[model samples]
Target: MTVLDPAMVPPRDARAAFRDGLVTPTAGWSAGWAQANLLALPKDRAYDFLLFAQRNPKACPVLDVTEPGEISASIFDGDLRTDLPAYRVYEHGEQVAEVGDVRDHWRDDLVCFLIGCSFTFEAALLDAGVPVRHLERKSNVPMYRTNRACRPAGTLSGPLVVSMRPVPPELVATAVRVTSRYPAVHGAPVHVGDPAALGVADLGRPDYGDPVEVRPGEIPVFWACGVTPQAAVAASRPPFAIGHAPGHMAITDVRDSAYAVP
Candidate 1:
């Protein structure tokens, strides 16, 4: 893994930390920016996936879609193949490779989808004085695939994947109000207080990301996550799919304010 120079990390460029060799995690970089989860699929499956997102807006809010063979993301002034520090290439449900860029693997028929990311709401939570533990610890927010079934479109269907944060019971309401402003990014809590409600048997053992402590007064708050789409894609096991490695997102030029509700 490439180690990053913290001194050189840019505040807004999503790929800056990766460029500086900061491979640790992105929970804290670019404080108030919107981060995006990516989905690249073969042209043959693009329309189906787009419809899937439309039907499941909370889990797959569409940010942008790219024409086949193009890497430039107009929303972020970025090249999709290089902006994200890491990419996971999956072929038929099996992970084929994890690499820094996808240029070598690029195909003329590939279409890219930029989905809303949870990081976009962290700023609001912080402003409301709700502590985001993962950001404080510089760790990726914990994510899990739950028993909740997503409304299927075509062959895309799977349980929802959620990101969890521990919020003090007293501040739970405030956290909800703050996050609800960004509907484009899996807004608000999907569940709170009980892991069993979401089929999460163990908080310490997550399907993705490291776990953190849930203090005496804290409740485990869960939010709909972009990972849901990836889980759906993985389950379907199309001929090929590519996504950003967890915590590493596609940073768009669009400001978080652009997605916030008044």
Candidate 2:
């Protein structure tokens, strides 16, 4: 069994995971700072992917786009190719490799995207006095594929993916209010209440991440997740692609308060 040592985890400024030799999942690190889901595409497909994200804003909210061969993003001032703690490289739709850095794979024709993630909203939920079960358990949030379809853009389209959080019925309203303030990072819950309504059959089983107990008096709340893009990219099977390993998001210098819309 591999034990994760918090002390061994690299600091937020270390840049790429390869720099710090971190190849583990990213959860519970970089508590208050905003983290982003990563997507890298060949320059030929960059325009199409960008339009797709624009067409389906809920699932693919764009935070920043980096020029080909450039690893840093405008919003965060960090290198996309080296900043993430870990990366998943995909080729023609199938995941070909997982690495700590993409510097070796970097190409002048590749464009990088840094999209919003649910971690930002999770922080707001905690601040609002709403319970976040996964945080309490020190585990990744449960994620599922919903029957709901995202609006198609070019070759990018797929069923929406959602992250689940079991909140008390009384605090559901509070969760919405707090999360709604940050639209760049997944915003608010897309579905609240029953999981089956979204065609999710089993609460114990999730397509991604770990499942947690939904205690009495609590309801499962689901939000559109950054993983949705990963699923789309997987299905599209681009010749070459890269993304942050799930939960190992790219920490940005941009403050979360900047995203809070009045």
Which candidate ranks first by TM-score, i.e. highest? 1
Give the whole-model CA lDDT for all candidates, comma-separated: 0.83, 0.80
Off by over 4 Å in 1: 1-14, 17-21
Error of 2 at 24 (Å): 3.9
TM-score of every model?
Answer: 0.93, 0.91
Off by over 4 Å in 2: 1-11, 14-18
lDDT of 2 at 190: 96
For model 2, residues 1-262, the per-residue Cα lDDT tens digits are: 9865542343454354435676544555555666688988888888888988997787788988887878677766666777777888888888887888788888888888889887876666777899888878878788998999887778777789998999889998998899888889888889999898999999899888889999998999998888888888887777888888777778776666777788
Each model's backbone clash number: 3, 4
Q: How big is the RMSD of model 1?
A: 2.6
> Model 2 — TM-score against the truth?
0.91
**Alpha-carbon error at 256 in model 1, in Å?**
0.6
Q: How accurate is candidate 2 locally (lDDT)?
A: 0.80
Worst 10 residues of 2 by lDDT: 5-14
* Cα lDDT tens digits for candidate 1, 146-168: 99999888978888999999999
How far is each candidate from the true structure, as Cα RMSD in Å?
A: 2.6, 3.0
